[model samples]
Target: MLQSLEIELTSNKKQQPAADQLGFGNHFTDHMFIMDYSTDNGWHKPRIQPYQPIVLDPAAKVFHYGQTIFEGLKAYKTDDGRVLLFRPHKNIQRMNRSNERLSVPELNVDVVIEALKQLISVDKDWIPTAPSTSLYIRPFIIATQPQLGVAPSTHYQFIIIMSPVGAYYTEGVNPVKIFVESEYVRSVKGGVGEAKTAGNYAAGLKAQEIAKEKGYSQVLWLDGVHRKYIEEVGSMNVFFKLKGVVHTPALNGSILDGVTRNSIIQLLKHWNIEVIERPITIEELYKASQNGELEEAFGTGTAAVISPIGELNWQDDVLIINDGKTGELSKKLYDTLTGIQMGKLEDPLGWMVEATPVNV
Candidate 1:
């Protein structure tokens, strides 16, 4: 861990984009936070500096072997000018777990949180206030040793960048069409699918592209082995409401344990709703839809919060959920989750943590 932190503000401030025009991850803030890791010194030299392009050798391990991991969360600007981070500690714990999976050194959670707060404070003005808008925080670590020996790097850089953004999907809280991908497998039981790594997403792009060509917003990936059991919906954890019970795939080392997924499960349990986590086969879901038991479906993630799956195209069989519209439970979950994050509702679970020392 670093002894102290340094700050280097930008000389020229960039003009802010219009709130209505702020798309997801398109506009960045003025500064970023960076820290270095070395075998000899461990993680040190923490600093907040100007947002600029990263400089690394072409032979860096991150380029050759893909040794990197990232975590995403949002900072919401409340009506009272307070900046809040939803379940940031959970994000940190997940990030560290990802670091372990990717063979990267673990991050000091307390120090990282402190740096996050200090960095967000420096660029607090960039926090968007539009509806469904927030400052997206991306914390990433890259192997920087510039070696190509197919081994972990001896040096690394951990950085945090902020993006002022709107909805991740164009549909926002509405329903989306999903194509069940069978041609490609996302990950296996003992793979890096659970980690929030770049490679996992890059591998899913081909399937996503195919789904896009098929008039779908995303692809619902099944397990690698069976190609029958459901795994996830694009980058989000999927949930299906069947016979008045909520069912989601268990995190059996393949599906990511999403922070939003956990929150949704907690919310459902708090409302005395039955939620089952187990291996759910796709055929079973299709059968449920055929029997009029499949009531609704939605996905949970940090970026898209709640994406209602309106249509699922499996083997050319179209399953329209809730008459191809957003379900009441989906809207309620989105509203309740967003409300708690924005301080518009009572936070019974204390999930939202103030990013700054006081209201900004």
Candidate 2:
């Protein structure tokens, strides 16, 4: 039996006219879940309170040293009116992995799931019904100890907030143009690249801006040492198709193992798609594209799912792959993945977990 948790609710009385027009990470819900941690007390003072500005010292470690980690997942409403979450256990395990990398405390999986269930129960109406739209849940930890030292803080705060988001690309499902960064790198061998830390994003922002200015949608980052092998694209794991074989960069220390990436791998195996995880170089991709052997290219992440990449801008040349449109395999993966998420298909893997309801 699940124990009912205490949650103090302060509903947003004045409904904003723009609530239905929520873009990605644009609008937030009414309440948030919060818990504090310390070396002596472990995890304590768990509560669900109204959404408001958080107060923090100017010299907090998170602000100065960037000791922060975050996770992204969603809650969906089925056509039959049942609410479900897709593979939340994966997110919990990933959160623990990130915490270990960032020197934060690990949380129990059941406790975290229960706390999230209680939260979504209160804000269940926030889930959107639009195609590919859902309530995005963000769970993050920040070092709150107010000190200037460059070490990990003894105090931390873990919070989960909900936001209604629409599709990632508003320009339709067209393929993306990626800017290959031969100079700047997203991660290194002995760095915190694999962890979903805040600093990694802050560092990648400049490169992203440059890519945008150059008419590219995202940056295709490469390894730091020789810049010979591919790493990742913006916030996604990339895949390339050559000779009917699906090849993606192996999980080196720099590349993040995305949840969508893992799911795609599993789905490919289910379909008997020859998916290979190995090191891929821009030169090799260029050769394949030039030889007319490159069949398709795409990127996988939780936010965008499987976004097709039609053109690759390597150096001063642009190489177009596929039909300059979303690949057929990309559509299949997207449909199957979103189908399972929206409860439209049989959850063969038992990934969809029902949320506990709140009493009126």
What candidate 1 gets wrong by more than 4 Å, as runs, is: 1-3, 357-360
Candidate 2 residue-wise lDDT, 1-360, digit = tens: 124445788955326325447778988888898888888988787788888888998988888888898999889999888889877888888889888988888987788888898889888877787787888899899999999977889899989998888777764467999999887888998899999988899889998999999999999998998888999988899999898889999998888988889888888888898999999999999999889889899998878777889888878788898868888888788889999999998777667899846652
All models: lDDT?
Answer: 0.93, 0.85
Q: Give lDDT tens digits, candidate 1, residues 164-249.
A: 99999988888999999989999999999999999999999999999999899999999999899999999999999999999999
Q: lDDT for model 1, on a 0 to 1 scale?
A: 0.93
Cα error, residue 90 of model 1, in Å, equals 1.0
Model 2: lDDT to the true structure: 0.85
**Model 1 reaches what TM-score against the true structure?**
0.98
By TM-score, how accurate is candidate 2? 0.96
Cα displacement (Å) at residue 146, model 1? 1.4
